[model samples]
Target: MSTCRTGTGPLTAAELEDWYAVPLGRADGTWVRAGLVTSLDGRAAGPDGLSGSLNRGSAGDHAVFDHLRRWADVVVVGAGTVRDEGYGPLPAVPLVVVSRSGDVPARLRRAAESGTRDGPAVVVLDGHGEDVDPGRVLTEVASRGWRRVLLEGGPQLLGTWLEADAVDELCATVRPVLVGGDGPLLVPRSTSLRAPVGSTTHLLAWEGDVLVRTRLR
Candidate 1:
């Protein structure tokens, strides 16, 4: 296991590659693991919606994010995150919104539309069977030819996937900052993998942050 610890301000490209490259292999054709950066105190969010505090990575992290987006046919995010972060669609990848309810904020719709030409296609995951249709949502997303999907999430979404055993890998970038707040942890609760679980650590050269990559064994 390779581990890097950073006491400096943020992360660099080398650090990002060291963190993200191996987890990229964990995702088979069907699923990809969710990746996130969290404070040592286990806060995924700051007071505000922006993760800028956690975004202190070198150019490499940005490049890694871009690569992940490119490799993923569909990028999945919870609706709340889309509203809070004001997320937009990637150039070529399709954006899949997992909303139990059909209430999608107009800004996301507009952003997805303007960014992706035909607007973003919304997929509401009706786990509750409320007013939405899960069948139609799955069908529409499948129609776009997105076989492999990546879920970039807030805690709740991550928890849901973990409970369902739908996650294939989990890549986490643990920064050295200790922002002790009752914010949120990377994983909501304890989860057991289906069978084998393997992990590797990469020590970043510049930043002392460690990237831990875990896959289903």
Candidate 2:
């Protein structure tokens, strides 16, 4: 995968890594980062109701996505995203999925059962309703020494975290394509919500796609 380039010039792979490197955890404290890709019109997913379609021609988005995963100690995702994306176990980093039913996906379970080299292990954090407590989820991963948290969300999960002001950073990829649909936005709609204020940390582009990293203090 190629590194992201600014409008002025291209960046090397190491430079890109430095821009997206995981921040060090302090004394069991976690740095929560949410990674999301959306279309030009702010649709989190395309017409198919999946984020993958929105990533069709965004190689730079994919590059950042992979880098975020690799740099994280563990990947935290909602159960619906796991099912919708047909997620398989990761090769290295452990995956912590939030599922209400406490049921592990068959594919993930199969990898665990066979003890294959398919990916790292999966831990299902059972929640009560449509989502789980963001703090609880973070605590679970932090307990396991996985403090560099990467949230690959499906709206509700991300929204909850954003509402709670638990997200420390946000890495958003905006593709040039416009997806007009009832798809969810980066943050769930809330009229009375106090959105977190963030500072732009890095902005990079590649193949007409834009990657923005924001730091929320």
Candidate 3:
């Protein structure tokens, strides 16, 4: 990985991979990963749902996001985030939603259908692993044979996965800006874990006052 000064600049695909990709060696059947962009002050959201405050990077960050989305077999997000972000399905990848409650919002259903021709698949994670019908949801997503799941979250969902110890790797972008408000942070506090979580820094590029990628240790 090469080091560039922190400011606005362009980043290449190679630079993106060097920073974001953290090999887990393929033993963990469920590869739960997160991609987040945050300001220097640690704000994850602006007044609106968009992370525009942190999108100061050159075209490189956009390319990186595209690559990450394409690489994953399935994209997983919380119900709240899906509604807030107005996400659509990817061309080749399937979409999965992890909801404790079986309830899915109306807008999400519409967005999912609009993104895919067949339809979008929903996965509800019942706390008891019972009562809810997993088979029905799996039928849609499983048909595509998606083994790797990419988790894109808005703090709360990411914190849930971390508390469950289900996350295998983390790919985070730390930007150099401070927007302190009643907004969300990159990662929420984990009540389940007693010790501090650690990560190894893999500096990809320095562009537009942002540091592209770092791996969870």
Give the number of the best model, judged by TM-score.
2
Candidate 2, residue 105: lDDT: 82
| Tens digit per residue, CA lDDT, model 3, 1-217 | 4333233335456755554555563453435567777777777775564665456543555666677886777787776676677665545666777666645666455554454244335443433433223343334444567656677876777776666665666766666667777788777644366565645444455444444443333
Model 1 alpha-carbon drift over 4 Å, by segment:
1-28, 110-143, 189-198, 201-206
Once model 3 is optimally superposed onto the true structure by TM-score, how far is the C-alpha of residue 61 displaced, in angstroms?
2.6
Q: Measured by TM-score, how close is model 3 to the native structure? A: 0.72
lDDT of 1: 0.58
Say what the RMSD of model 2 is: 4.4
Candidate 2 — which residues are off by over 4 angstroms? 1-10, 22-29, 101-104, 109-117, 190-192
Where's the lowest-lDDT run of ten residues in candidate 2?
A: 1-10
Error of 1 at 137 (Å): 7.5
Which residue ranges in model 3 land beyond 4 Å of their true spot? Answer: 1-9, 14-24, 28-30, 56-58, 107-144
Q: For model 2, how does the per-residue alpha-carbon lDDT over 11-125 read when each residue is reduced to its tens digit?
A: 5678767777655644566788899998888888988999998887677888888888877889988888899888888888988888866566887756655666466677777
